[model samples]
Target: MDERKIRVVVAKPGLDGHDRGAKVVARALRDAGMEVVYTGLRQTPEQIVETVLQEDADAVGISILSGAHTFYFTKIIGLLKEKDAGDIIVFGGGVIPDKDIPGLLEAGAGAVFGPGTPTSVCVEWLEKAVADKRAKEQ
Candidate 1:
């Protein structure tokens, strides 16, 4: 496999104004040596998907606390499939209820982190996930 940094797009699904969690995770991912592109704030699902394709990102991490997690995740994942980019990993973190996790996963979210989960956990998982994905492509 070619030796290249894993690229990721971190987005705040355009609805909620709060992006503290998104910023924190973006910094952690960057610190972990991944190439991270943070889509400032209030990004529509369409914009986020566009960035992922433009960056050739291996994954996208969405930070949503707007109680719109299901809506955004389903829409983004569907859009990716429509774009024939379903192989791109879609993971996220935010204030989400436990009951909604399975539905999110079913909708094609690779994983979902809840509030207070350690950022290191996200980084480790993402690194492994992207590495595995790259290996499979090879």
Candidate 2:
């Protein structure tokens, strides 16, 4: 993780049409010197996973405003595991309920940001998480 840039794919998954938060977070990550690919709205779990793999990202940040957080998270994580790409860290954001946080984590989300979470916070967390992941990989 030294000279190599931390690359991440930011996606909006499921029927969630809202993507303002995702774009803001993407910009913050880019501003923080990370490579960010923003996969726009209405992405299927399979598509997101494909983009992550194709981009060779260190992590993926999914933004979903729909009530289908459980389904999307489970499907994406399961797909990554199936593809033997479970090392790509998964994180999520949007209108998800607090009660669902633990379940999302169990489903393999590294973190979940609810409404009102600062983009800076997401950027900071992602930086540390990606760094830790890279360290472990070595």
Candidate 3:
């Protein structure tokens, strides 16, 4: 298999203005040798999915703190499915409650990171998930 750097789109979907975490995660992914495209703040689900398609991302990382994770994640996942891009892994992070983690996963999120999650953990997960996805594609 040809080795290729994983491509990821980091987006903030919703009205939330806090982006320190998103920027941090994006940087972390870049530092880990992955290509990271950050969509900035207040992006709608459609916009995020569009970015993913345009970037041909292997995965998407959404950072939300507006307490609307369920709605935003569900819509993003649904849009990806509709676009036949559901193979693009989706993960989330923010002030998500523990109780909502399961629902988020069930909604098609591969993983959820709560506040205080180490950037390395996110990087590690992406590395593994992207590798697994590539293996499956082959």
- Against the reference, the lDDT scores of all candidates come to 0.93, 0.91, 0.94
Predicted model with the maximum TM-score: 3
Q: Extract clashing residue pairs from model 3.
A: none
lDDT of 1 by residue, 23-128 (tens): 9999999999999999998888999999999999999999988899999999999999999999999999898999999999999998999998999999999988
Score residue 38 of candidate 2 by CA lDDT: 97
Residue 80 lDDT in candidate 3:
99
**Candidate 1 clashing pairs?**
none
lDDT of 2 by residue, 107-133 (tens): 889999999988888888988898898
lDDT of 3 by residue, 8-51 (tens): 99999988998999999999999999999999988999999999
Off by over 4 Å in 1: none
1 versus 3: better TM-score goes to? 3
**How do all the candidates rank in terms of TM-score, highest first?**
3, 1, 2
Point out the higher-scoring one by lDDT: 1 or 2: 1
Off by over 4 Å in 3: none
- Candidate 3: global Cα-lDDT? 0.94
Worst 10 residues of 3 by lDDT: 1-10
